[model samples]
Target: MYKKLAIMALCCLCFTDCSQASRSVSCQVITITDGDSLTCLLKNKKPLHVRLADIDAPEKNQPFGNKAKQFLAKLVYQKSVQLRILGNDPYQRTLAVVYNAQHENININMVKSGMAWAYTRYNRDPMYLNAQKQAMKARLGLWQDAHPIPPEQWRRKKRK
Candidate 1:
């Protein structure tokens, strides 16, 4: 009985807000705001805005933008995911590495499948780099466009 009580206490602690740092949480994808941003319902917590770490997808008004959102939706909408939280972004979205039920790395998959970029300025993982290279070489998804503008560039252009 003492062991069971200790385990219960630990579980309770894990679910609290103070334990969010570097913690993993099981969540249900509530909304895919864009290709790289989503909202999820974390267990016993408020809805969390999540930014896919180490990748950037086209903006909604950019080339292949809707397609990127669609692709991400297909992969995660209403599905349970495990978020390995790294930290928070400037916009307060939880910056995380998301894994699906089958344990696939959703960020790398987005890059490999050509729906997103490796976001090289912030990420140097070989897996992400190789995925981008392979996707470009294969001319998959957005790579089919000979001069696809990055989302960052597209956003800047819009502001001008």
Candidate 2:
């Protein structure tokens, strides 16, 4: 009887997870709040907060911060985009990849354009990393600054 009860509980848990996974929805970019945050208008008649997956940008007060925000804004602000929701972040924001109106991947474009850096710690996309490396090699955007501080390290310094 105990074994049957355990199996039933496991099945219930699996079903719940599957249901949650199916809740993924898409959206179009209404604004780019920052490098990692944006506002997307969803089909459900709600505006969603989108946090980019696997990367974090400099804080607003940090060096090159505004530039990053501007770059992202130019790419997607007020532009139609396709968002592939990954899941909800700890802050209840939707973590997603935002593609352009043309169906091109925006994240990869940011990296390729030297507007953003590849977050090697969490992102395993080799193409993104490679693009960033190429940009760095060409001394583009933030890379052009001889003493540009990394966003992660800037955060650490601020916490002190």
Candidate 3:
């Protein structure tokens, strides 16, 4: 258990580019703003806006974007989840690795199912990398697109 926590901590430090430190919080998901972000209500009833770490989902306006959002909603909306908060993003949303009650990592699920791409910029975990390769090989979810555009790239083009 000690080793596991240590590895997870290392991964968090490598995966998050944030302005704050890491912590843990338990909450109930109240809303899914997009495939990669959600609002969770803390036990005290305060809302924590969070962006999933290690993966980037499609932009809401991009192809497969709504599908990704629906997929995330189906898995976590209203569910009780635990978040390993790494830090705050520029938007003030907490960046975290979210796990379901069953201890399933929801961030990895998105990549495994191809609803999201491993956010390689900060993600260096082999599990996430492997999942992405398998998803692409099996052509799951958004991988079904003959030429799927990554969310970051899609966003960049949109701003042009």
Candidate 4:
């Protein structure tokens, strides 16, 4: 029992001290899978899948789905971006706030442009919330619809 406890403590210490490890990666986008997801090639690592944190864009087949993907592609496709790793979601995609080489926050920009919804489930940033409000008030992008269905709800309905 004592040996097991010591081993566990060592493991905890090893994992906790990750300051030497990089939490962010600079990569070139290899593909835009969807509005909220993309694959990028890091310098020495395999292609990484990233899910935009704090936003949910429409899925293909849903309203404005293609437009959302297009918008994302225009913003980041073939561009270098910095991924601030925020860990992974249940789906195993790395959740990150992607910033373009210009330092523009692509995740928040998606919300501001009305191409994505502020994912309140995993975020409570006032900037994102405010951006959604402005987009909705201005009837921008997907907000042009009389009743834009949230991607999550749309997915649930499809599953049922």
Candidate 5:
């Protein structure tokens, strides 16, 4: 009886993680909306608007914005992507951390490459913060700007 109970518990634990991992959506990125967003076509012919989670890229008008977008495009456009859905943002876009076929985390790479800032308020991962710090130290991409303004602040200023 004890052996049977142990086996059941092990199965439950395995399925819990497996189910969450299996929830990932397989899709093709048809368009690069910006540095941190994309338009994808799911296998079921459904369209999903995805916003990269835990990172914020520059606004189109902001310095290095186009570079950020271009970088993202080079990484995923016209390629199959795996999206692990976290949730939706206020804008109703599905928030996800995208992965390439090689299993690389695209969102974190954006930070590591200095194309985007780790959205500190929403990102609790020390790896993300560490990547940002390293990028800043190396003066990559937007970090090259002596005073690069974050997208959040840039958007607020634009609103005003």
Candidate 6:
């Protein structure tokens, strides 16, 4: 009886850990504000502001900014996505790598398709970095300009 009890306890522990590791959080894409920012309706029916992890899109007034917005809209607007919430940013937006219902990685795809730049400051994903480099080589989207200002630099210049 003791051996059976021990086996049961072990099984329970393994089940608990597996469940925690593979848990899926559901969220609806309420709005796609731009390449980086969006509003999501979480499983609890609460609206959440989500920032795409590992990428930065141009601001509204910046070059290719409108194209970024349109690209994101085509990818996520009014669709349901899954967010593996890494944490929250300083701005209170949930910092997450979102995936579509089809299990496509939206953040990496944006970089690979030349719609956004890989934000290396907070992300160390080598695949994303390579994709961005490839996009630059191909002169995709924002890279079409001989010297396109990075979104971060553009924001700094505007502040001055």
Question: lDDT of each model, Cα atoms only?
Answer: 0.88, 0.74, 0.90, 0.89, 0.88, 0.82
Alpha carbon lDDT at 111, candidate 4: 95
Candidate number with the higher lDDT (5 or 6)? 5
Sequence-dependent TM-score of model 4: 0.86
Clashing pairs in 3: none
What tens digits encode model 2's per-residue C-alpha lDDT throughout 1-160?
A: 9997786576454332222332445666787777778998888869988877656666678766788889899888877777776566657677677788688888777777766778776678888878888988998877888877778888899899
- The local distance difference test score of model 6 is 0.82
Candidate number achieving the greatest lDDT relative to the actual structure: 3
TM-scores for all predictions: 0.86, 0.79, 0.87, 0.86, 0.86, 0.83
Per-residue lDDT of model 3, residues 60-138, tens digit only: 8888899999999999999999999987666768899999999999999999999999999777899999999999999
lDDT of 1 at 47: 97
* Top of the candidates by TM-score: 3
Error of 4 at 42 (Å): 0.5
Candidate 5 overall Cα lDDT vs. reference?
A: 0.88
63-157 per-residue lDDT for model 4 (tens digits):
99999999999999999999987766667677789999889999999999999999987678999999999999999999999999999999999
Candidate 2: residue 84 Cα off by (Å): 1.4
lDDT of 2: 0.74
**Mind giving the per-residue lDDT tens digits that candidate 6 earns over 1-160?**
9997786576454322222233457788988888789998887899988888889988888999989889988999999999876656667677778899899999988887788889887678899999999999999988888898888899999999
Across residues 54-150, which tens digit of lDDT does each residue of candidate 1 receive? 9999999888899999999999999999999876766767888999999999989999999999998777899999999999999998999999888
TM-score of model 5 (CA atoms): 0.86
lDDT of 5 by residue, 86-119 (tens): 6666676777889999999999999999999999
